[model samples]
Target: MATAAIARPQVSDAEWEARQELAACYRVFAMLGWDEMIYNHITVKVPGEDNAFLINPYGLHFSEVCASNLVKIDIDGNKLTDNPYPVNPAGFTQHSVFHRHLPDAHCVMHTHTTAGMAVSALEGGLQPINFYACNFIGQVAYHDFEGVTVRAEEGERLIANLGDKRAMFLRNHGILVMGKTLPQAFLMHWGLQRACEIQMATLSMGQPVHVPEDVVAVHQRDLSKVQIPGGPGKADFDAMVRLVDRIDTSWRN
Candidate 1:
């Protein structure tokens, strides 16, 4: 008989929170059918200084993620934590391009949901087709697809495409949105997802969809005022935590 050998990964408390949130984000997105298998990633800048980021380990389903599962890496893509989970270099390239330059970007959310991919395939990109689309109006950016995004050279192109916007539609790929806080990013993602859903449904109906310029302008103004009154935008965060609790509360475990 042959004996089996195994090695375990170690994660800390700080990394733990990052894992929980990342896992919850995954579970919620999976529940919504927004995951692109294990391809797309959601990364959160580690709290405080040190220039660290946390991401999913390569081979696991999002639903299987937990506080103990995330892998930490530095801006240079070096695995800094004591975890044996292999980091995806291409995934790091996709995420690090933003983290290195975008100081305001703390939580980066990327998804390959059906609606997002459907809209990405359209030559027009995300048009100002409706009010929800207006939330993305001038704020949306675009990145052209450059193969599988595995090359380090592609980082420059990704950065150029992202430019100065917090929301982007990666042509031939999917959607990416960044938030200063998790709730802000998550809310923006909700808008982006809803916009994609509307785009797909409307286009499938085989009818032209139109939004008056004046109406889009009005909603843009309304969206500008759409922040919670005080306290670190935790309301939406709490709400989402509750939603995660309803489905699978073990993310924190």
Candidate 2:
């Protein structure tokens, strides 16, 4: 329950840009059918504070999310802004633990996508069955289902479960991806969830797998390029924001 400082400086230009990117990530998650109404959340650390972040207001659907609609709150789940909307304590509990403990994790994105849940429930979590699957090699963590992550007591457990990892599979639930920037988190979540979907689709075929450890390791190294700043996936975030604008400009309103 770390609280943000009361007299912090105003949002810097870079942070303002991040807020817009994070909002677009939420909308793109919705567009990709990864959102569970307004139940899930994507949070980003506000500039200049290790314990402060911007999260979507609890009542708004992802489609209704706009940059201005995002709420600023402390890692302890306290709202710092003057928005009339109430923060979801349950979602805050889930997000705060990660932000409080992981200093490098600027953006934490979670979703209850069907494919993600399916993969989480499988006997093997994120088996190396596809090229995309290797992107998570030696990096993913798994947290047992704690019955919805609504209580403050769950925070410590969740943080420990996610220790030093960039991706987490909440068993019988969904996925979480942490990144240094909103765009990076969005890209990782995209790959993580899509990898799960690919695994599910391949399993449905019920045939022998083709993954080799050497091959997976190689692909994993190559895919690391996408995670680099200024890579194609990095550019995708800006493009996706424009895509959202094309589909529904009101998200900016």
Candidate 3:
């Protein structure tokens, strides 16, 4: 698929902004070594259209995704724009279901990072032993894996298992996170990933100390609706986007 910049006015400013942010997200994941080749997906619903979303071209690496080349598709995976690139079947199947069912799921991210996969494979799942783990003590949900997630039936189960939770682990597979905003989702995954990495490291050595539930409850209560000191907010996302531009502003295309 060509990465050539899409001509302007073909899309609304809101849609274009969504493209740039989604593209920047891909690059940020690439920089963090969280991408699984060209397999995993980060999807964002187009701001101006209902049930319409954008995904990376199936054959393109995260680094290769640009605002213009990102494929625009509807909830049913039908291409809404003319493009040489195709959308990944698995990505579409899962992402569409989430978008259709959850209003807050404006941005859905699925990844197969080593730590994310490792945590998913573990029977214990993500434990509340690390600072990052505290953000999702009782917040994480789990789903039983049903082969590759290309089938629509599997999507129903995925959403059912997801319930109202923002983060989910596809047991024996990987991590899935949703957010009302990209910053929230990205921060959730970052915290989850760091938790898993720390858990794996500490478990290899011996029994790890767990954070108290009372403390987590308190934090969860206090953390809602307010931007804590180190919390991932819009500011953090803006900083990361700047970093992506420094590396390569092609994402802005």
Clashes of 2: 0
lDDT for position 191 in model 1: 83
Candidate 3 TM-score over all chains jointly: 0.94
TM-score versus the correct structure, for each prediction: 0.89, 0.89, 0.94
- Candidate 3 per-residue lDDT over residues 1-253, each given as its tens digit: 4455555428888898998889899999998898888799999989967789999889888988888889999998899888887788999999999998898899999999888899899987988888778889899999988899899988878888888798999998999999988887888888888888998898999998988999988878877666755545577777888888898998888
User: Which runs in model 1 stand beyond 4 Å of their true positions?
Assistant: 1-15, 230-233
List residue ranges in candidate 3 displaced over 4 A.
1-9, 224-232
Ranking by lDDT: 3, 2, 1
Task: Enumerate residue pairs that collide in model 3.
Answer: none
lDDT by residue (1-253, candidate 2, tens digit) is 2222223225678667667777788888778788897789999988887778999877788877776767899877777776667788777888888788778788888888999999999887998877778888678999999796789888787888878888999999889888887777887888888889999999899974867888877886776564555853678787777877778765544
Per-model CA lDDT versus the true structure: 0.77, 0.79, 0.87
TM-score of 1: 0.89
Q: Please give, for residues 1-253, the per-residue lDDT of candidate 1 as tens digits.
A: 1211223245556656666777788777777777766678888998874488888777667776666667778988888867656777767888887888889889888888888888988988887886678878778988888777778788788778778888888888888999887777888888888988988888888876677778888888876476776444467667777787888876665
Candidate 1 achieves a global lDDT of 0.77
Q: Is 2 or 3 the stronger prediction by TM-score? A: 3
